[model samples]
Target: MTSILLDTPNVPALKVENLVVDFKTKNGVVNAVRGVSFSVDRGEVLAVVGESGSGKTITSLTTMALLPSTARTAGVVEVDGHDVLNASEADMDSKRGNVVSMVFQEPMTALNPSMKVGKQVAEAILNHRGLSKAEAMARAVELLDRVGIPDPAVKARNFPHQLSGGQRQRVVIAIALACDPTLIIADEPTTALDVTVQAEILELLRNLVKETNTALLLITHNMGVVADLSDRVVVMNAGKVIETGTTVQVLTEPAEPYTQALLAAVPTLPEAQWDAIFAEERTGEPRHAEPAGNSPLVDPVLDMREVCVDYTSGGRKLRAVNQAGLVINRGEIVGLVGESGSGKSTLGRAPLGLVPVTGGEITLFGGNVLKASTREIRKLRSRIGIIFQDPGGSLDPRMTVGDSIAEPLVMHGVNGKRPGRAERDARVRELLEAVRLPAANANRYPHELSGGQRQRIGLARALALAPELLIADEPTSALDVSVQDEVLTLLLDLQKEHGFGCLFISHDLAVVHSVSQRVTVMQHGNVIESGLSSKVLQRPEAPYTRHLLASVPSPNPIVQRQRREARTALLLSSGTRGS
Candidate 1:
């Protein structure tokens, strides 16, 4: 490994000393960051990693002088030898885009909705570089192309909404690169992206830093990312830095318990053993068992034969699902694994009649879904459940938790009759208890709950109907690793208790390997590979499947470096540089 410390540096690109930030809340004074210190030299990547609410983001924000008015901060934050904490408002504003810049976590919210992406990037340049609109726009297009955006000229005119999530994030990066700042702070830049897109973006960032000799301060919770990109690392917990070392040292031999725990919580491949451990932890009778005589006559709960789903956008026909076929037998979990735009979501929703299939057949319990009547389809839906990726977006803000859970019951008339208020309320309470939430939490709104709690609420809502099949679309993608473990465990337990076959769709291979007994890999709307989860994930047969597994970064720095080298060799042999 290359030595991270600068030996012949004239001056560091960024530095912090005894940084402390506090916020006065209704409860008390909240210490967001306490006595944190680190530095990033020119061309160096320094990663600060921690769980949610661990003060990693706060430290980066404080370094940028972008903290809220309520925040009280002290100590030093220097960017290119300039004191950020002590800079005047006007000076800080002048220094923001020129000396230091930031790429936020969520590009959709960070970018202006009304502005064109090209104009947005140009505006950042116009603010600091004083270029004409035409010149700035041209430069913006160049930056977009530099960041690997295809057909940059055509894409430049598009609004943020028109771009995919990965493209939007690329636009955000282009904006950050507009001014060519000396230091770049990327906060969870690839959190919600697919593994392939994330790999591309990470490669882009690494190349840009090397070519421009710019320092990068990356703040994220993903240990894999730290292993993949960071030269040095600082581990933080509850507003304090607990460990600091070169990337190899810190990741392989962490000195702090929090850091160790964080690493341990990360999901990895060869998950058959982990699944067995989880099964043993389960109480009572086995949820999955063959009927008497180990019979093979039981039909699958969900079956799709040559399923095709199509859409029309901008006068162009988009084939989202193309002749895909799969089956989920009773009480079995089948993982649908793919990158974004791979038709995983479309396939998951096709059986529920949410997305119409243009051709082919989908059968739920021998009932034709594509050719079923409206009333028949309505009846069919009562036996199906779906858990969306974002619980906050899926749950109605105007409704209370209890009412949201009971809405499906009220509509379906759970017991063949319109349920009374008392009956619905009782069911809601029992659902809450089943998900391990307090009965009192039934009165709370979605916003009142934590991220994990809200996800559990979403689960309760999905399981409220006692359906035979559950379609979980990236349910734990937004949660922390520890929280994700809890949610996964809870999902397994509930699936056992309810005996529901699950179609678990996710872009995370490790997560898919953890809970899925069978796995189906999709690519560009096609089911490329299907088999036992262990064989497909651990020893993938397809080149694309192997590439996906190779792209996932391990928490161990040594292993991650080896994986990176192997990926590089694969790319070279395939006649493609890093995309």
Candidate 2:
């Protein structure tokens, strides 16, 4: 047996060699990571970019020596000369909270709901150091302040739910940095936040890494973040690292086709692209689009006028949605964009009669849906389709994929209208084909497929009734960047062929710009801005619209390089000014 110390000459901050990890299951062994190797130097920012199930998370977990007991791993993970893989539980514990720490993706799930934030952070510090409780709490407040919280003293006493998403993420970062760990692994830290908040967090992390002289391993699917924050980038796919290089090298000239394809998939907000898209819209032909027939368009799909939804909480009437009005014309695609609580979803549901409208007219295909009977609404419900954000939760575990897709057809009395069992199976195959999924995959369960595949299945089910209008709520937000491209493209093609109107709602402006014909910006339950997609996107008039547009991430190497240079110069200048 050999003992490894923390300090060694010529050693990098962290090093991984020939790492392999496997999980045991009922069917067989799932090999997540296979012979992966990477290293991070002191004060260096390294990014691991990959799609879901690419073994990126597993690799990071293995390096941290956080694998479960049922899992088997063989690797050489040397952090500051310590062999983490071969270390005992007690030996690992000593370094786990002191030498290396991680910030998880979902802050809500990571934090303890019942405890105050300051106490939680103080516990981490108390475990690592021999400091008194008061001293630990003082350090916690300092950490919160360092992470950009406005009022650390008051915020520290609040619970997790009391804070916003960005604030919670900052708290998580504060906790991870409490002990001044030499190495930090941030796994999808910005995925849950809006673009503006994400930018701020990335800048904060980059600045902290530089100031503390710490090494950072950032796992993300956002190429923009990679470009702006990472010194070096590594591309992973299917348990392997395909490419690794400096950010400039990878963004400017990539040797691998996959790398190039990934970069291309990220939607860039180039002025020329927006102008051209709008120019086509001006001519009434739309941009980069095929002519879709109105045959599939239904009459009076869903309509709403002067709709308002109000909620009473804590003796205060909060108008989540004001006299907001909307109408989903048959086969016409309308996009909705707004901040976190702008009543977009509320207005979306008003037409379907899902949410109670305080004051407004609601109709479906010219039918009076506002006062329609339950049976009438039920009969027309199948004619309108909706795909929610969480596709997995929306699906049923007890039902197989085939049953789930076929359920709508069977319920609508259309299944028996088909020729026979053989013909019905053919229809199921056709629907799956429409979504670009393998027909044979219908027999498998949803759990077996990736998130993207599940979402496609959700789309398949939504389209089962051949609905005239489709309501998609943040459909692509949960997917990886590469998968999101395929899904968005598929959605556009389907809408073209089916001539079905779509109401696309999302927080992602880039996605909205790419797929939507008309853009509407909402704030505080009011339609602050609305017009042709090209005009609004290219020339935003409202301040909030400008803020939202500026938040979108761009893939252009030159743009990111310039931004990085500007920030670096500002920091240098600020230092001189302070002196």
Candidate 3:
């Protein structure tokens, strides 16, 4: 690409004009992006926010010329006055990493697993700048250090699998910064990371942009990330931009209906606003009423006391859950909140005896779970349900939706006996309808449905046996904001109707606060704090709990900026960085 120097100094670092992208599929033509226009100036962060299939990623990929050959595009994509759309093959190749770079969503998938992270970053530098191997490697270490990776020299020799998620992402950012590109496109950079790690990554990106005066194009579904970093915002839906304005204007005072819906769907920690919105959506109806007759003799659906779970890896014992105790009464929703690897999932599995308990006791309906007989365990399985984090992976790919939902019923012999084919089929249809999916979807495969639809299918299958207790482990983490809202609402509605207790495990504090009556905070396999959601989240006692709450980014830019500043100050005072 031949660079065109603009006469005026006011030219944006990156610009797109009337961009349109279409994909020709066997079914029909799909319009991915339609006449979308945006610009990012030097030292500016521009965010494109949208739900899944809203064309945010498509627009970014087209801008970087990274889309597959099947994608047809008509747009003016320019970086530093170099027209990216019309650039020659060689020019595009040269400009890809030299003038522009992209940090993908999943660093594990983006980084070369076979190679050491340092070597991969060094390769980028060598390919673009023609530097010596030794020099490039040294620069790689420096870049890693710049991105806040501890012991950069030692970490450079480690393969991608050896590093944590946040470290791997830092390596990806290092590679992107290796060439000193004027424009950087970070696509969902922190979506898969824990909140504390997310804060650090966002801080690093913001600092890098400020230090280098580089333009940043951030594509994400996370409104919090947009509020925390972006200076301007572009809201997209159904392959079109519905709103565009300053971050404050768009987040606080969205003019479009789609934008309003998207913002309203985002889960927030403050209960009053969320409850008010939920009440309004339900036509001023309360979410749940108090139980009748204040009974004194009620057994908890799930109860754990001094539970401990351990595993031996490489002859070393790893404690996953230590003295974790909690209680969930019938029809109550209790949230388990923590960062990744904080033993939340392990504790969630204790009720069903999925994880062996080394100490303490777990009781389900007043029956000992740890020492249950085979027959008793089999019986327990029918009354307990689990919703995994990834519905795409958890759902059986080879089975039809009907068979998948009916599998549990087939195994458990619902209603004390094995049901016939007709009964099974009817139960499956009933479940699909209960989850708000059409009965016709029973014949469709999981791959044919969207992420939200697949999650609903998972929920339907989990509830196929009419379980008394549900373990929802990060059920909506991978979904879009609106879809997450839908799933959470459905879960609440179902819990109310069936009066089943729920153990909601998630790292999202806001989401946990919205659906859960009580909250338990865990860190490093230990229960740090436990109390009512309103009290624990609003007036957290433990330092770790306070840190977790503070790390969450708000949708309001001004408030989020203050939170970021306060988090940085706290970290500095503690003489440590992100956990």
lDDT of each: 0.86, 0.80, 0.87
Clashing pairs in 3: 1-91
The estimated TM-scores of all candidates read: 0.89, 0.88, 0.93
Between candidates 1 and 2, the TM-score winner:
1
Clashing pairs in 1: none
Per residue, candidate 2 scores C-alpha lDDT tens digits across 1-579 of: 122433443678789888888899998999888888889987899999988889999888876788898789887898777888889989888877678899999999999999999998898899899899999999999999999887899999999999989999999999999888878999999988877678678878988999988889999988888877889988888888899999889888989999999888897754423344334434645323211321122454666666788888899888878776555566566789986788898877777777767787777767888678988887777787788898899889887887888887777646336345575577779989999998998899989989999999999888988888899988998998888999999998888899887889987887888888767778889877776677677666554665566556566556766544433443343353112
Candidate 1 per-residue C-alpha lDDT over 40-123 given as tens digits, one digit per residue, 9 for 90 to 100: 998999999988988999998887788999999999888887888888999888878777899988999999999999999999
lDDT of model 3 at position 373: 97
Best lDDT goes to which candidate? 3
Indicate the worst ten consecutive residues by lDDT in candidate 1. 288-297
Which tens-of-lDDT digit does each residue in 1-579 have in candidate 3?
234453346778788899999999999999999999989898899999999889999988876788888888897988878888877788788888778899999998999899999999999899888779999999999999999889999999999999999999999999999988888999999999999889889989999999988889999999999999999999999899889999999999999999999999999876223233323334634234222311112559887889999999999999999998888889888999999999999999877777878999888888898889989988988998889999999988999999999999888987799999999999998998899999999999999999999999999999988889999999999999999999999999999999998899999999999999888889999987887787777655565775687689999888787677656655654567644
Instruction: Point out the worst 10-residue segment of candidate 2 by lDDT.
Output: 288-297
Deviation (Å) of 252 in candidate 3: 0.3
After TM-score superposition, what is the CA distance of residue 322 in candidate 1 from its true location, in Å?
Answer: 1.4
Displacement of residue 324 (Cα, Å) in model 2 is 2.2
lDDT of candidate 1 at residue 569, scale 0 to 100: 58
| Residue 264 shift from truth in candidate 2, angstroms | 2.3
> Which wins on lDDT, candidate 1 or candidate 2?
1
- Root mean square deviation (Cα) for candidate 1: 7.0
